[model samples]
Target: MVIIEAKGLTKDYGNLRAVDHVDFQIKKGECFGFLGPNGAGKTTIMRMFYSLVVPTGGYIKIFGMDLNRHASYIKSRLGILPQDNNLDLELTTLKNLIVYARYFGISSSKSKRKAEELLEYVGLTEKAHVNIRNLSGGMQRALLLARALINDPEILILDEPTTGLDPHSRLNVWNKLNELKEKNTTLILTTHYMEEAERLCDRVAIMDRGKIVAIDTPENLMGIYGGNLEDVYLKLTGKKLKEENNVENNKS
Candidate 1:
């Protein structure tokens, strides 16, 4: 049932090593999360999972199949939502999903049906014909989510899935994610939101500077570290003050 296995996974951009020899395993149907400060290689690892980046060392296997040999098969079963919005501005909300579904070789008729179903599921039926640029931030986020699920993927890979949404919108997305997990879909998510990670992830791996510094269930990790997930994370990574600086810089 080990759905994801990373053995000394490493990625480097010239002399700048983004992901070091990191190792982790994720079980089938488990909500596994990756947490880290900005530029901590969380994105690099995420990109590697979806074959966006070639690694400098080590290897990964998904569903017991070596990623190098079976990337197409592995990707066929994946649903990905990147941290940044990448919707087609020229396409209507429904069309976005329809086009993405076509990449999976879904029949045109089935793709249209799937698009309509997902649009309604995300509560965007009214705006299904709206241009992507005209939708509100929250609405667009929901649409992006709907697009990810259009293919009915077995493994959902979400990077900052609920970022930039209001509390209401965030909760809605959270509920949808919970429903997906209930149906036994394996999820891998990366987020700066500790609360989201604690709420959704059965286990989380805290990465710092291209390496996994800690990995455990939220409760067990908190128990072992004698604090909340954020506190435990700060203690292990020793980046509380640095993170604060980064936040301040972003605001300014």
Candidate 2:
């Protein structure tokens, strides 16, 4: 039931070594998270998972198939939400989903139905015909989630899925994620929000400067570190003051 296996995964950008050799495994239907400050390589690893960035060394296997060998097939089963909003601004909310589904070769008729269902799933049914630019930030975030689910992917990969939304919007996305987990979907994500990781992830890997420094469940980390998930993150990554400076300087 190992859905994802990374053995000494590494990535490099020109002279910069973004992701150092790291190993991890994610089980089927489990939620696995990567937590780190800016430029800690969390986003780099996320890109590697979806085959956006080829590794400089090591390998990754999704569904027991090597990512390098079966990237096309593997990507078909993955739902990706990058850190930025990449939705087509010129398109309506419904068209955004339909257009994305077309990339997966989903039939137009079927994509339309799927789009409607996903909008309802994310509580955006009323905004279906609205242009992307007209929706509130929360609504756009929900549309992005809906679009990611259009292909009904078995594995959902997210990077800062709920970064800028208000508390209510964040909670709404969290509920939808939990619902997906209940239906046995594997979730892989990277986030700076420790509470989001603690709430949604079964286990999290804390990365620092391109390496996993600690990997464990939120409760276990908290138990050992003696504070909330945020405290555990700061403790494992570095001193709070120094870590803050590092995060600011490393923003990518």
Candidate 3:
């Protein structure tokens, strides 16, 4: 039931090693989370899994198929909701979903029907005809989620899926994600938000400085550190006061 298996995965940018010797496995129908602070190489590792960026070294297997050997076949059954919204602004909310569906070879009629159902699911049915430019930030995020699900992908990769939304919108997204998990979709997500990871992930890998520092269930991780996840994170990756002082002095 392993949907994703990565071993010795590494990625480099010139002399900088962004992701180094990481290994993990995600089970089918499980919610897996990558939790890290800024510049922790979380996104770099995610890009490798999605095959957007080829790995400098190691192997990535998605659904028992090698990513390099079956990139097209793997991508066909995968969905990605990146940190940035890539919706075409000129199109209406519904049109945006329809266009993405076509990329998966979904027919126009079927795409339209799927789009309508998705819009309703995301509570944006009334804004179906509204241009993307006019939708609120939360609405756009919801639309992006719905669009990612249009093709009924077996695995969904989400990068900071609810980064800038209000509490209600965040909760709505959490609910939808839980619904998807209940339907047996494998989910892989990256987030700096400790609470979100705790609520959504069955297992989490904590990365820092191009390495995985810890991996376990949120509760177990917290128990090991004798504190909440946030405290544990700070303890493991403490900031250097001297470095902060030097940066402040340089700015002045």
Candidate 4:
């Protein structure tokens, strides 16, 4: 089953087009990746999927329903981990999860139980009672991930899901996400980490200047371009050494 279908998807900010004539289809249980530099409109495409921003022109269908008509239902089935750290700092880790779970109408008892399980799953059980302020950057990202999964939605839209994590922490989250994939969850991801996409995504779309420049399985993309993802990116989009260094710096 095709979980998502988009054609001619476009988004504009005044004179600048943030996403231009994008098109893609994601299978029900496959991992689809969106890769690009900062401000390449990857986030804009993601926001469109979750109906956070209305598109200027396009057609989208989620779960066989029109995006325009079924946005509420579609959003209800989406789990989103935005790039920004938007966790409620005033609340404890457990409270943070429980409160967000309430948005999906989960019962208090069930939310608490699921919160406990996720805290354990994300390796944050020991810090569940701690305030968000005291947690490390990586721990907070993990908690946000756990919060995104509290409802067990059919689709997960992850934006740089491992952005703030150490190598060990990032690996742990990767394993958990792979487990979810094994259970047939559709995932849409946006990230600057080519290796992460290569490891996790069944296929990826490369975007530049609000447009999709390429789309294929990671291996095929490499083969067609005669190099690795970074090479392909550089060839197609023209990599800047400073930008490359910045990505490396942030990943560490």
lDDT of 2 by residue, 40-150 (tens): 898888898878888899998999998888888999999988888999999999999999999999999999999999999998898889899999999988888888888
lDDT (C-alpha, whole model) for all candidates: 0.88, 0.88, 0.89, 0.89
- Clash pairs of candidate 2? none
TM-score of 4: 0.94
TM-score of each: 0.96, 0.95, 0.93, 0.94
Candidate 3 clash total? 0
* lDDT tens readout by residue for model 3, 46-133: 7887678899998899989989889888998998888888899999999999999999999999999999999999999999999999
Question: Candidate 1, which segments miss by more than 4 Å at Cα?
Answer: 241-252
Q: What tens digits encode model 1's per-residue C-alpha lDDT throughout 39-112?
A: 77888888888789888999988888888788988888889888889999999998999999988899999999
For 1-252, candidate 4 gives per-residue lDDT tens digits of 788999999888999999899999999999999988777898888888877888998977889888778887777888999989999989999999999999989999999999999999988999999999999988988898898899898999998898768998889878988999999998899988888989999999988889999999999999988777888888888874238548757886
The segments of candidate 4 whose C-alpha lies over 4 angstroms from its true place after superposition are: 240-252
Q: Native-vs-model 3 lDDT? A: 0.89
| lDDT score for residue 148 of model 1 | 83
- What residue runs in model 2 are displaced by over 4 Å at the alpha carbon? 241-252
Q: For candidate 2, what is the total of clashing residue pairs? A: 0
